[model samples]
Target: MPFTPFHMGAGLAAKAAIDRHFSVLTFGIAQIAMDIEPLIGMIRDADVLHGPTHTYIGALAIGFAVILVSPFICRPILRRYNYEARAMRASWLACPEHLSKGAVALGAFIGTLSHVLLDSLMHADVRPFWPVSNSNPLLGLVSVDAVYQLCFWLGAASAIAWLVGKYRHGRENG
Candidate 1:
């Protein structure tokens, strides 16, 4: 799957919303990219799939699935982070009262969904409205090229560095 800054951005945003569910967001983007690029390749003779997965349904389904399983997969991490054991259990059970439950679910869903929508906006001919219509709309300014990839890597690195710096500053001040 092509690594686009669109998806990377979504993943980063997801981290803020879900408190570290970027993996699910990025993974969902990759998954959707893999599924769509091949089909897009077949139709456009480009040798990749980049169509259906960019649709709204794809985003919803994948996002829902990822969010649904997040608590289970991240249980240990949550515990490590000092989440109450009972709260964690309730989140795992999808209880509304769990402190971070909604945030976690929304984070995963939004992050994954954002990747799909963001990719849709960037491509020249994405079936984002697929099963509904097939109009090629261009909503992005950057082309999926090496330059864009560089920007993504640099942005992610910068965000990481800034976060690390802030953490260290806080520690030192404390």
Candidate 2:
């Protein structure tokens, strides 16, 4: 909600829990995709910061775009990542291989959709159901601090899960 990094907590949790079914990398890209509208609106001094891009329709479009693009980007990156982690004796840091198409789609959709829902909680201008209802009933349903805590706790839990997994697999570095 504050920035893309804030979204990583949920992404990491999803990746840790779902394993091969989710990709935090693709989710990060999708967060960027969802935020592009707000970034531009802020830059141009537009009245509506979280406009169309913070809607289900907009998220679907962003997800599709990410699905189409992530493979090309994530594959090469993961190849190098796998190699480097192995070299560093931290094989758990590596993904088995590049995420599958389904995983990419899952991550993209989850990232974009969750971004809208989370922002809707704190931002008044975010009409998550825009063009249909143009109302953000979910707005302020939860406090901003609560959302931040949720993110922090989810990230911590994911990190703990990852560490437990790494050591269980006997691949933890040091």
Evaluate model 1: give its TM-score.
0.56
Pairs of colliding residues, candidate 2: none
lDDT of 2 by residue, 46-67 (tens): 8889888898888898999999
Off by over 4 Å in 2: 170-174
lDDT digits (tens) for residues 35-144 of candidate 1: 55455576687733565666777767766766666656555554554446345552231212233656665655665556555556556656777787776464554565
Candidate 1, poorest ten consecutive residues by summed lDDT: 90-99
Q: What lDDT score goes with residue 28 in model 2?
A: 87
Model 2: residue 13 alpha-carbon error in angstroms: 1.4
